[model samples]
Target: MAVGLLFLVCAGAVLYSAEAQDPYSELPDYYKRGVDLALEQLNSHAGVHHHFRFLRSLDKSDIESGFGVRYLYHHFYLKPTRCAKGTTESNPQTCPFRNDRPLMDCAVCYKAAEDQIEPSPKPYVHCIQKPRLTQDMRTARTDHCKKMTYNSGAPTLLAVSTG
Candidate 1:
């Protein structure tokens, strides 16, 4: 009986270690699919080289229960800006915005409009001047360090959503 119990414990340990080593290996099929889909969308929208690290299963009951599918609160680092990289400290006083205008809703807009793209919202009046580079926007500490993790290379969670 003791030998049998010991074998079971060892087996469980082995399985746990294996799962830890390859985070995606033990994910349920639906969960894996969701992560893959999200990653693809992020890559295409953000940039091919943008990095992402999975934090954890936000909620699997939806997929397990055969409800459509949703991954709520799975944390990820947005692609860092060039200014972020150039800054020396996590809490730097300021950083430069990208010189060229960056795409915002453009990708989704283009996908929806396709060849029927319309000119900029008629008359194209600027609503407000862009903030100066010296603007002291206070980034959350977690966000500032998300891509700057220690040797492990995974960002600590900045914010998580319950919904």
Candidate 2:
């Protein structure tokens, strides 16, 4: 029975770690706009059938490049939404997340300066698709997509650790 107890302890620790890794949900609008800009670039380049929504930020940093120029670096997660790509509905917030699709780990960096031109240079964005979602990601999806339900027709996928 000691082995069984140890297994339970280990499982609890793993769950806690996942929860602890989640970033803050209450971010300022300035940071959220950064996420939107990243999404715009990501959706444009991605070949995926569905558009991805910003799930949560993993980390962020603001560094002054020079002479009043600030560089914003954002690392975040993106989850596939029910809305199809190139749809007339421009708002990803209205679309529900698809549990069947893979989660995306993404990072974007861009210059933010008050004197910058109207159309700032495209942010440098890179993303990798993770085959499975972490516990924290699932929790975030649930909270973020609370306004809509998951697609019933899509097959429910399980989250397996790649590690």
Candidate 3:
């Protein structure tokens, strides 16, 4: 009885650890799809040179926009990879992260619905570059991005946006 109990405990612990390591695994299929589409959009932006990989999700929200439509919002962090933009030789998964470039904090908002005849709504992509790696600098940048309003102007090192 004791041996069986020990085995069950070990199995449970292992499963819990696996879940903790990949928070994305718990997200719904639609959410995962949204993240992939958002990442692709982020990479295609002219301001982005090197490829970036998803680091972690900062925030997310799902809102019912009346009828069958729903709005999805995802805010996440991205780290630059060694691969250059539009590089056919390497992908984000295989490319190692580059320490030289600044980190990106991005937010994507889009609409989702079933049996929709109209074209999908254009996604809103906004990314803020965090050049400094210091803890205080990161906090300040995060705070600044949270407060700043979205802009549709030309891209800069400090901000990149697409609609």
TM-scores, one per candidate:
0.29, 0.54, 0.54
Q: Give one digit per residue, the lDDT tens place, for model 3 in 4-55.
A: 9999999999999885554445556655666666568777788878877767
Clashing pairs in 2: none
Better of 1 and 2 by TM-score: 2
Q: Which is the better candidate, 2 or 3, if ranked by lDDT? A: 3
How are the candidates ranked when ordered by lDDT, highest leading? 3, 2, 1
**Which of candidates 1 and 2 reaches a greater lDDT?**
2
Give the Cα lDDT of each candidate: 0.32, 0.60, 0.61
Model 2 ranges off by over 4 Å = 1-26, 64-68, 88-90, 115-122, 131-163
lDDT of 3: 0.61
Among residues 3 or more apart in sequence or in different chains, the pairs in candidate 3 whose N, CA or C atoms overlap within 3 Å are none
Report how far off residue 58 is in candidate 2 (Å).
0.5
- Candidate 1 vs. true structure, TM-score: 0.29
Q: CA RMSD for every model? A: 17.2, 16.6, 9.0
Question: Candidate 3, 27: how far from true, in Å?
Answer: 4.5
List candidate 1 segments past 4 Å from native: 1-20, 63-163
RMSD of 1: 17.2
